[model samples]
Target: MTLLSWSVIEYSAKYDAAGELGHVRDTIKWGADYLLKTFNSTADTIDALVAQVGSAATAPGSTQPDDQYCWMRPEEIDYPRPVIECQSCPDLAAEMAAALAAASIVFKDNRAYSRELLHGATTVWNFASDRAGNSSYLHRVIDSNLARQAGAFSAGKDHGVFSWDNKLPGAQLLMSRLWLFLSPGYPYEDMLRTFQSQTSIIMCSYLPVFKSFNRTKGGLIQLNHGMPQPLQYVANAAFLASVYSDYLEAADTPGWNCGPDFYSVEVLRSFAMTQIKYILGKNPLKMSYVVGYGQNYPKHVHHRGASIPKKGGDRGCTGGWHWRDSKEPNPNVIAGAMVAGPDRHDGFKDVRKNRNYTEATLAGNAGLVAALVALSGDEHGLDKNTMFSAVPSMFPSPPPPPAPWKP
Candidate 1:
């Protein structure tokens, strides 16, 4: 079912790009068929999910309700309303609007969804305004939903609030995508403000404390602590630099990991690199790094001297053998090197020896490389295909004025 939905969206996107009426018709047909299939197979499951969510929302001592289930409520109510002709029908007009906007891509005949998408964007704008007006720490309120949910949990110990922090990013990402398609008249100033404000907090609080060491050269230097390497900082820098290339100079800073784990590093680097490339017109392929080989040693090595675990025997006697061997380059550093050079050479080796790669050695520095490539229009030794999907589309035509809603 998920795959079907994804394919429908994907094909619809292609059809939209082609702008062929017949293709659009075919795309809509496919989407409607998939929707019918989903409705038939998952009707009971959907009903159950909606009921559960509604009950939770209405129950005594109910706290913050989950938005996922809340979204489903509108879906369930809207899906059935279009099929029924009763005077006292469910009021799922909002949900219907969202669904129609989503489906309109596939069914070009329904341009009405474009207006719905704009309305939804306005709704978000309004919510953001309301929160900003009321909250003292507007930045914190906008940056994370965790604090809000935590407060709810404290207030209502018996009835837990469903946390929204994890889901907020995805929601924002989607809304931003839809807004791109709808091109609403309202400025994206609020969204940009929130992003920049959060970025500033991250830079001020974390970037200064990152510690850098030439793992190959064997020396520890405190650069900054808690610096979210290639992910948050690098990505943020890349975005800023793209917007105002002068900031690229600031990209040269050592990065530090908040948590010492492969997954954490991977997530940070991948997300940062991807965003940098997308925003700065850089080659994503060049940003790609190898993982699981301990190839990039300097980035992973702890500046503090390494220690071996003690080995003990059953007889309360210490064993001569060390539990784990201490190596100059941590063998477990299995991660890919950031893409570098117009030739797309593995930049890891240059940085690994710690000879010249300084703050410039930061993985996000690749964004600078991208910026250079883009500015120079250098096609040589660059992979265009890596960023083919990341390029933004032309602004969609302004939606027709919304029709008056009938009761």
Candidate 2:
């Protein structure tokens, strides 16, 4: 059962990524077949169990004498008998129930999938509603539908799931682009408020440690000694913040520096770039000040101890590298930039180059650095190049001159 469930999820992702209408159709068909098969097999077992339960009732000295017991009814029996019972009849019923639920979900998902395949944005939005009446397992489907419908109303354009309000800041940028394509007259203020709400939760609550650390460098965000320390929470929190720009505002808070070492920083940056085109409009070139204390240096002290040169079998910076060794970048940088406009070419260029560098020489580090650069621009100070260089439109230009001496 687990394998089957995973298969459907995996295939769905693959089909969505394929971006080909025909491929999506075929993938949905295959998924439907699997679901139907599982359902039928479960149903057959249920039928056989009902027959056995009836036979048992008829046997001599059985506790169940006549049809007097309400539980005697086949439908009333525990669908998937409890472990204590271990009776085949109950087990069969349980399996059947699960299979039916899965089938129902697959049906709705297929409808949305089909509508997307046809490039019918309106159809997809209409199908996204919870009209199917299966709330327990279909809440995600409903949410997804609501988001997509909202996006359709905003943007005149249509794409598969890509044209939906994802409740995440980074995701919103992508949806906004589609909305623009469709030319829908959406309420920008309402959208911004929604993003702000999600960001506040992620920054203040989810990653309080990171927030604390952002306020005080020596605080919890830096402590890695104890279990469930602020570092892990910060990692996760930063990840959430990066995807949602509301958290990006948190970056403006003092003491926190965006860089590759911060795990969440990089993750968030990647999400933002994929959805948005550029970071906030402040061009990196406009800022003459560059602080080197946090740039390009490792953020976490623990990482310094973990570092080993390539020849010594050390991981050798294989993971993502940040702008500052210690400070983590905000994730929404990418998405923000993408949505803002193409003028931020320098920032995008920096991301592409840095991403390539990390990809070839230090694969893991590249992702981290790329995400950070995308988020905070060059301000975190990993390299001396102007933050302006990281914008998407700044391509074809040579790397910016090294930073001038600090002092």
Candidate 3:
């Protein structure tokens, strides 16, 4: 969640929307710091760290709700958080990779901080890339018999990330693409070539064409494209399209382009815009999955923080927090959040219990911010050579070919 939040805040700040750049910097620092802390604090020997923290599951048919039923702050939990740490999950590592790499660019002026982020990103990417595939430890964790016994998939069905196994390649591709855009020279050049190869394979399997499997009266909401798919898949593709568009926007200037196959930047931008609009409100559902986007947006978003209202005065922190599952509307709004999107047939039910349609997630937000950065358009005032644009100049200058072998 912190990673996703940072992705949005960083892009918004870079685009000058998450308040002023200075204030947004501080906010983004909090997230980056936490991710760094989480990775650094771990004593495990793995080169990568997990991106999630959650309690162990209850037995199937368990009548009692999880800790969330208590309706208390996370600090108030009776015990230390029980979590399954994927010390080397490639998907999680890839996400962290993208987050840190992006953060490094955002904080490029702070050389030390940017280097720290870069170092972390580079390490995680290396670990994830080395451990990519079906037999990886991450696949074991998500596709375990223990999880099946506990009905985790049944629960996750409400959240739309049902088949997490297939997402790693996409995450890896995006992370590699982003890293390639920001890096130059030596090991990075080698890394970029490796990424381009992986991207070719991934693109062929997931999104070979610029266009979607969308029909005239149907699209992602219909889920008519494939089996057990997550909205994030399409969303990730759109974000990649936007990334390509960003490259094109910098084509003549930033010195970045994927290949000769991609020339019509507007086509990519248009596809991105189409997905963004569908997410915002233009789907057959005619409802905005994001909070506060449209008149008919989802009210009962499945988020803990947004369900609670601000407490002050007599209503202090000690009190005023409880489960209030009423139709009175959430007293607080999780603004700028993107929920799990509509079902097939563009059907949607705005219910907190229907987490598949209402839950907000890190992957969802990461994709959202990427699209938002593009949709918000470029901040013309900022220096053009800041992030990806600055990459070409960072390459190591040759040593004049050893002075023409002056032996």
- Candidate 1 residue-wise lDDT, 238-304, digit = tens: 3222222212122322232234521222233333344444322333322233222232223322211
Q: Give the TM-score of candidate 1.
A: 0.23
- Per-candidate Cα RMSD to the true structure, in Å, reads 19.2, 23.5, 8.8
Candidate 1: worst-modelled 10 consecutive residues by lDDT: 213-222
* Model 1 regions lying over 4 Å from their true place: 1-110, 113-147, 150-196, 203-407
lDDT of 3 by residue, 1-407 (tens): 33333344335445565455565467567777877775652322245365556544367654333454334444444534555556557667766666677778777778998888877766666676673333342233333363345343232322222123344334444435455445544444654555455444333322325332433354552222543224555566666655544543453433223345533556656666777788888887788878898888988877655665555213323242443344546667878778887765567777765677788876566667656665564542223344344334445566665445554
Question: What tens-digit string does per-residue lDDT give for candidate 2 at 1-407?
Answer: 21122123223333233353244344445643443332223221222222222222445555543332112223223323321222234323433333333333333446654332222212111223212223232223225455555452242212111101222333343233222222223333344344333333333332333332222211223212122212222222233334234223333322122332233544444434432221122233221011122223111221222222223332222222321132433221211111111111222222221321111112122122223332443323221112112123312568889989897
Native-referenced Cα lDDT, model 1: 0.29
TM-score of each: 0.23, 0.22, 0.64
lDDT of 1 at 93: 25
Better of 1 and 3 by lDDT: 3
Alpha-carbon shift of residue 76 in model 2 (angstroms)? 28
